[model samples]
Target: MTEIVRARGLVKRFDGLLAVDGIDFSIREGECFGLLGPNGAGKTSTIRMITCVSPVTAGQLRVNGMDVTTDRRRIKATLGVVPQDENLDPDLSVAQNLAVYARYFDIPAAVARARSDEILELFQLTEKRDETVDNLSGGMKRRLIVARALINEPKILVLDEPTTGLDPQARHLVWRKLRKLREQGITTLLTTHYMEEAAHLCDRLVVMHLGHILAEGSPQDLIERHVGGQVLELRIESDGDHADALAALRDRADLRLEDVDEAVYAYSTDQNWDPVMRDVASFGKAARLRESTLEDVFLQLTGRGLDE
Candidate 1:
């Protein structure tokens, strides 16, 4: 596959603080790539550099084979960005907002109007095309932002928390539109805190933390390699001497133990959890089984829960 975006030893700094510490990665043509991380983890800084809104402090960064510093105009023309916060023009109508945004690229007035019409229909906002941006709901505003981004028909789309504050139905709508863009062969770069969003949409992802890459792989591969397969959750009356009880279950050598907030978590590769239950049964019946998830992987990797 051809690499559409490549960064080697990329670094960014704000005053004396490092926002993005030397990181390297690439996005292949037509692939959905994700930067998964919590806030202040350098994901936004990386995106800003990639979009040419901010210059890299060090290392080589290329998009569509053009160096960002030297080819700012070309890169900007080829890229579309949806920032985490909506920056729609409140005074303008939805259709006017798209039209004015497209004009920034020097699009013909007739062409901009046509594009706005088509995009409004695509976003299911044709009925509200004449409505002022400030009157629209949060979800409507997000969809309008996406439609405006697509007005340029950019080869690369970069979204930062595209569904951050939307309702479930609105989020799914955005997902469906994104899937359509993928089918059309647009390379997508996404940065989001929602793990399930990354798992469902991204072809591959890198987990970022503390301005560095923590792990890189497919969602399932990361879960299996880092979080184990099946997990036995025990909410005991009291975990007094639970380590001794856990030691008795050494017959299953594949399991790893974790104790969190009065709950004991037994992780194993094998799906059969009978042996673990039997061992914990000696203590009490409060133990239960839970399927492993990417949340578990995130928690294990960062030593804290994703929401924390």
Candidate 2:
């Protein structure tokens, strides 16, 4: 696949504060790429640069072989952006919203109507076409916002925290639509703190922290490389030889232990847990063994949860 977006030594600054600290990454055509991190991790700043909303302080940034610095107009023309905050026009009806946005791209009125109808059907918002934006539910509003972004039929879809504030069913519905778009060869770039969203939608992702890229790989690959195959979570108790149990587990070369607030997480590459379980039976009151996921990998690398 060809590279649709590329950055090398990218830097962003507001006065003396460095938001994106010389990061480098690339997005291939038709693949869903993600920037996974907590807020203030430069995910939004990076997206702003690519979308031509902010100037890059330094380094090279390109989209579809065009330089971001010199080709802002050309770049913006081919990109569909969904911002973190809702920006839909509340006074306009759902169909009217899409029609007005299409005019921004200089799309013909007749063609815009055809495209609007097609996109509304794609997002399952056809029934809400004539309803005013203010009358829609949160999920309906989100779907309409997404539908409006596609009014230009852009080559690359850029979403910043696409599923933020959505309920489970609504989020899942949006996820399904995004997956369908990916299958149709629309390249996607998204910024998200939702571990499951990134794991489900992104083909590759970079873990960002304090405006730096900490790790980059497929979700499963990152999990295997950082946290391992299985995780054993044991609640730490002040009484009953818990410290001794921890010390015993630490003695084993095969286990990696991470101590968070009220629990100790044991990571192991080996699938078998019988031996490890025996060592914790005496001290642990609540123990859970489960498959390691992107969340575990993030906690291991960042020393914090995604929301923190």
Candidate 3:
């Protein structure tokens, strides 16, 4: 597979604060790659460098084998970006929004109109074609924004938290549209906080925290590697009686333990999970055991701190 985007020792800083601290990764052509983290985890900063909107502070970043510093225009020409913020022209109708954006790529008037109509139909927004951006529902506006990004049929689509604030129905619709984009072999770089979205969409992904990549692999691979096959959450009622039991639980059976707030998260393989839970019961603590997930691995590496 061709490497469409590559970064090595990439760094970004603002007023002496390191935002992206020397990270390395590569993206293959026609695969969906994800960047995931909580708020302020440098996800947006890394994307800006990839999109050539922000200059790299240090190290090399190449898009389509061209350096981002010198070949920004060329790189951007092949990129279609849907930012976390809706950048649609609120005053223009849905169809006009796409037409105006198509001109940015120097698309011919007739071709722009045709592609605008085509993508509108593709995103299921043909009925809202003549409606003003402000009149459409949040979901319709999101569809239009994604449709506008494809006006130029860009080689790479960069989506930053595309489904952040949408309702469940709207998010699912957006997911369906993104799945279609993937089926079209679009090389996509997506940043989202939703674990389910990452697991469902990403072919490969890296977990980022504090400007560093904590782990990298396919979703299931990362989960199995970092978190084992299952997670047992022991939420002991912090009524003083469970303290000794919790400590004893931690030392039992060579288990990996992460203490977050009031919960002691334990990781065990599926083959040993039943016996592990049986051992925990001897400590007189009630625990809930379930399959380990990407979220479990994320919190384990990044901690439970709220990034606000």
Using all chains and alpha carbons, the TM-scores for the candidates as numbered come to 0.92, 0.95, 0.95
What tens digits encode model 2's per-residue C-alpha lDDT throughout 62-137? 9999999999989998999999999999999999999999998999999999999999999999999999999999
Estimate the lDDT of model 2: 0.90
Write the residue-wise lDDT of candidate 1 on 1-308 in tens digits: 99999999999998998989999999999999999888878999999999999989999999999999899999999988999999999999998999899989988999999888888888899999999999999999999998899989899999999999899999999999999889999999999989889988999889888789899888888888886676777764545655654566545667787777666677776556775677677665567677688777776766665533
> Which ranges in model 1 have alpha carbons more than 4 Å from their true place?
239-253, 270-272, 282-285, 305-308
The per-candidate count of clashes, in order, stands at 0, 0, 0
How far is 219's C-alpha from truth in model 3 (Å)? 0.2
lDDT of each: 0.87, 0.90, 0.88
Report the lDDT tens digits of candidate 3 across residue range 216-303: 9999999988888788887767656357446656666657777666777887543467666676675454677778888988888788
Off by over 4 Å in 2: 239-241, 270-272, 283-285, 305-308
Better of 1 and 3 by TM-score: 3
